[model samples]
Target: MIKFSGRGLLLDIEGTTASVAFVYDVMFPFVRRELDAYLQAAWKTPALEPVLRYIAQDAGADTFAAWTQDDATEQAKQQRVSAEITRLMDNDIKATGLKQLQGLIWKSGFDSGELVAAVFDDVPPALVRWNEAGKDVRIYSSGSVAAQKMFFGHTNHGDLLASFRGHYDTTTGPKKEAASYRVIASDYGCDASEILFLSDIVAELDAAREAGMQTGLCYRVGNAPVENGNGHPGIESFDQVSIG
Candidate 1:
């Protein structure tokens, strides 16, 4: 059984609290398919420029050049940007643009019935129980905070975003890095010992443990470990957890 001694619960998406295949199959494919169109439409949007700048910087291209107006060379730039984006995605950098773009792209798939956010049947009840017990419940995912909101707000489960107290994204830090967990603990204004972090990935749980938080691995049905020698405790359902 997994134990929670914390004053709050910090859960991960795309594997721990949610289905991994849902993200890789539903979310990632949509991003890959519509990325070009999204960039074309959002090139001039004020909120998205920083993400463009990040792309330019990563590609070693000039960031000062105005990308608002597509020129003859725009396609070349987009190709380079696409390549750089692939690298960032492979490395799992929590770029805001990547997350925002994913949210926009996934929006279409979700609306078109191509995809739906998949949460385990037991998640909502456990979340409600956590809330009723006066324990804060938060989300920590590689997905941007906005994307996280959209996923929960429009899941097959329906509008479960209200069950959470807060959301965190890669902006908090790289999920694999221990310092990020420290930052999360600070953000929650609670001792790390009082925070339970649940995830399916051992590396993330290791980082959280280093930050002094408790951890549980949510081995949801149909999901299997991708790595060897993951020694952390694992859970098949939220029903297995005893949260006090």
Candidate 2:
């Protein structure tokens, strides 16, 4: 067990609170299957414009219009964006634009009861325990903030969104960077040492530790094996963590 006398808790989603398989097998496939239909439907809508601009910038273009300069028709531009999204997913690239688009797609699935987040059984009770103990709990994930909200709001164990104080995503900064953890600390309005960050990735934990936050390496089922925890405490479940 690990003991933390911290003001807040920062958590990672995939491979930490939820299984990696569920993301790769269920959520990602859902996005791939629905990508074309969703993109066509959302094109030209207010919500999709910013996301397309981001994707354009990610592709090294100044704007979506510039990116699709060769595409004379709306369908052509949409097809280009679709192709780019597919390429990104094929490589498992975690570009901000791709994540944002995936979140939008996921929102539809979640709202239509086609998708339900699969958090571990220990998660809900632990969230309640941490909240009751007066520790502020938040999430720092690569997924978009909107996706995180939808995910926690529609979990198999019921809505866990109320347990969180805030959410952070790639927009905050790369998870492997110490500066990101520092930014999170500032957002939490507390010293870096007053927050405990947990994740299944040792590099992320190392970054948090570098930022002076306590760190724990989670060992959840279906998570990629971590040969070296880099001296961080290992937690198989939230039950193993005692917050003061």
Candidate 3:
């Protein structure tokens, strides 16, 4: 029954509001299955050229400006892009470019009714309670801000985007760094002590604590049965939290 009084609620997605399995099983597999075809179909357009450039930059293929500029014939270029994208996915690199591309792919899946974002049962009600109480709720995750919105906006509970104040991603800073939490606190124009941060990762909770925010570790059913070895408060669900 650990409790903290704060006007701002900060949340981590994976292993917190949503099951990590949904990400690893549904989202990652969807991107892997669809990326090559999507790239092949989109290469001719100006819209995808910039995205390809970002992917190529991360792949270390510096001279591969875009699909249109690849040295080989178009067929070979498709093969190269597909291979590079596959290699990155296989390695599970959390590169910003790859994440952005995955989010784009997921947008298609969500729009086509092939994918539905998952949220824990306790989450939506907690979000609504917090909003009604006038507490500012924000998301901070490794997923890009756009991806985070897409996820919340399409969850089974219906659009939860209106419940959020804003979002943060790795672009703001690394999750395990205290400076990042400080930045978010500053961005919200509040003292870190006024924010309560919830995540499944101990290091992230440690970072948030260092930033002067209250912290909790989410211990969902699918997560490891590890003890709260880091001394942070442990919660099994949002039902255990209160903003007001």
Candidate 4:
């Protein structure tokens, strides 16, 4: 067991508790392949306008507005959005607006039993163990809060949402920035030192550490390999972690 002292646990999703392959291989492809279909289906839905607007805004107001002009058919708008979303995915930019919109689209897939989240076998148990021990557990993923909840709700281990206190996404601010961890600590009404952050990325751990939070580098099998663990205690399983 790894020695730790903290009041709560902070977690990264992809490459931490879940397989990176699930995100890069499965989720990204699913979103890319289904983007056009989802856009076409939601074309007339008023709720979809905000998501479309964000896509346009991110792409370029003048160009996208021209694409959305009166003479431009719904199909043209969708084609543009789909192409732009594909570009974002290819570049792997974590845009808040795009992330939320993708969460909405993924919701449909989850509801239809078409998508299932692949959680590590050790995650659910460790979550329960830590939570039961009175340690608060929460997630901080690049994915939206809704998307995080969706994945946990549909995980192979069954509903694990109850094991978490809250979720954080890019909306909280960029993960590689120390200020974001400070903000999260303030929001949680705790000192940064009270939270232990677990992630597969050294830069993220470095950020958390800079904010005075304890950090651990998760080195799970099939996760993207790291050249060095940056001197943080490495965890192969959530079982290795303890917040006490």
Candidate 5:
């Protein structure tokens, strides 16, 4: 059994604490449909110019300023930009534009009643138990912090956002980067050994392991396996996680 010497818990959302289908079928499609409008509105916002410029740079736009132009060539460039942005999203890269775009698109879905973030039946109870036991429960997802909040804020199980002690996104760092877990362990003010990271993705587990944290595979039926060779623990559910 995988064990932790610390008091903090780092949990993943999709395919771990929550269902994979909720992210893949509902959230991803919702964002894909609303991407165009979201980009347009976000592009027009003066406050978001820096973020847009970052996206342009990430997407290989020749010049950041040129990316904001309204000419047909710029429009074509943005189309290519959008495609590349989608690709990064699919790979769960830590792109700021992708995060903002997801937040906007998810706003549409949340407002229209098209979807609700769903967690497993045991999640809420487990979260409550963990908290009552004085363990900090934090969320780490590729999705933006805003999207993460919206999900728990409007979950099928009701507003579970209150249960989370902290929220992290790609803004912290790419999920597969060992540095991100180090950042999180530091943020939690605990030794990496005291923090237990739960996720369905093996690569993320590997990264967390490299960062010196205890790791667990969520073991959802449809999700990928977390290889333990890199220092992650394997478990099927919160039920399998024993903290004494």
Candidate 6:
């Protein structure tokens, strides 16, 4: 068991609190299946406008309108966005725009009961324990903040959103960068040493440790094997972590 005495907890979703397979096998396929239809229906709406702009910017253009200046029709512009989305997905690129768009699409699925987040059994109770103990808990993930909210709000264990105090995504900064953890600590209103960052990736743990946060390497069943933990303590369940 890994015992950590900290005032805050920053968690990673995939392969940590939730299975990586649930993301790659379920959530991702859901996005691909609903992509074109969602874009077609949401085109030019207020909701999609900023997302498209971000996508355009990610593609090295200033705006969606500027990117598709030669497309000559709404359909063509949408098709361009769809194609770019497909390319990003195919390459497993974690672009901000792609994550935002996926979050939007996931909203419908989650609201309609078509999708449910798969968190580990130990997670829900641990969240409650930490919250009750006055440990500020938050999430840092590649998934957008909106997506993270929706995910925790609709997990199979049910409405775990109340446990989290804040959310961070790539918009804050890359997960593997020490600067991002420093920013999270500042935003979370705690000294970096007061937070415990838990993730399945050693690189992320290394980054958080570099930023002065305590770190734990999660060892979930479906997570990729970590040949070297690089000195981070390993825990197979949240129960092992005792936040004071």
- Measured by TM-score, the strongest candidate is 2
- After superposition, the stretches of candidate 6 with alpha carbons farther than 4 Å from their true spots are none
- TM-score of each prediction: 0.87, 0.98, 0.89, 0.92, 0.86, 0.97
**Candidate 4: misplaced stretches above 4 Å?**
44-46, 60-71
lDDT per residue for candidate 2 within 15-119, as digits (tens), equals 989989999999999999999999889989999999999899999999999999999999999899999999999999889999999999999999999999999
Model 2 stretches astray by more than 4 angstroms: none
> Evaluated with lDDT, which candidate comes out highest?
2
Q: Which stretches of candidate 1 lie over 4 Å from their true place?
A: 57-72, 87-97, 111-114, 226-231
TM-score order, best first, reads: 2, 6, 4, 3, 1, 5
Q: Model 5, 1-244: lDDT tens per residue?
A: 5555479999898898788877888788877877776766666577556556667766667666665466466566557667877898789676776776677668778877777887898888888888888899999997778888888888888999889989999879889999999999999997898888888888898899899988887788677554453545567778777668
Q: How much lDDT does each candidate structure score? A: 0.78, 0.95, 0.84, 0.84, 0.79, 0.94
In model 3, where do residues sit more than 4 Å from their true spots?
44-46, 57-71, 74-78
**Which lDDT value does model 1 have at 215?**
83
Please provide, for model 3 over 1-244, each residue's C-alpha lDDT reduced to its tens digit, 9 standing for 90 to 100: 5575678999999999999899989998998899878877777787566566767777666645543374558777777777776777798666666776777778888888788889999999988888888888999998878889999989989988999999998778889999999999999898999999999999999999999999989999787566654988888989898555
Task: Tell me the tens digit of each residue's lDDT in model 6 across 117-199.
Answer: 99999999999899889889999999999999999999999999989999999999998999999999999887999999999
When summed lDDT is taken over every stretch of 10 residues in candidate 6, the lowest stretch is 1-10
Give the per-residue lDDT digits (tens) of candidate 4, residues 1-244: 5677778889999999899998888888888778777887787688777666666666666444654786367677677677777778888988766787788888887888788999999998888789778887889988989999999999878888888898999879899999999989888789999889999999999999999998999888897779988888898998887556
Point out the higher-scoring one by lDDT: 1 or 6.
Answer: 6
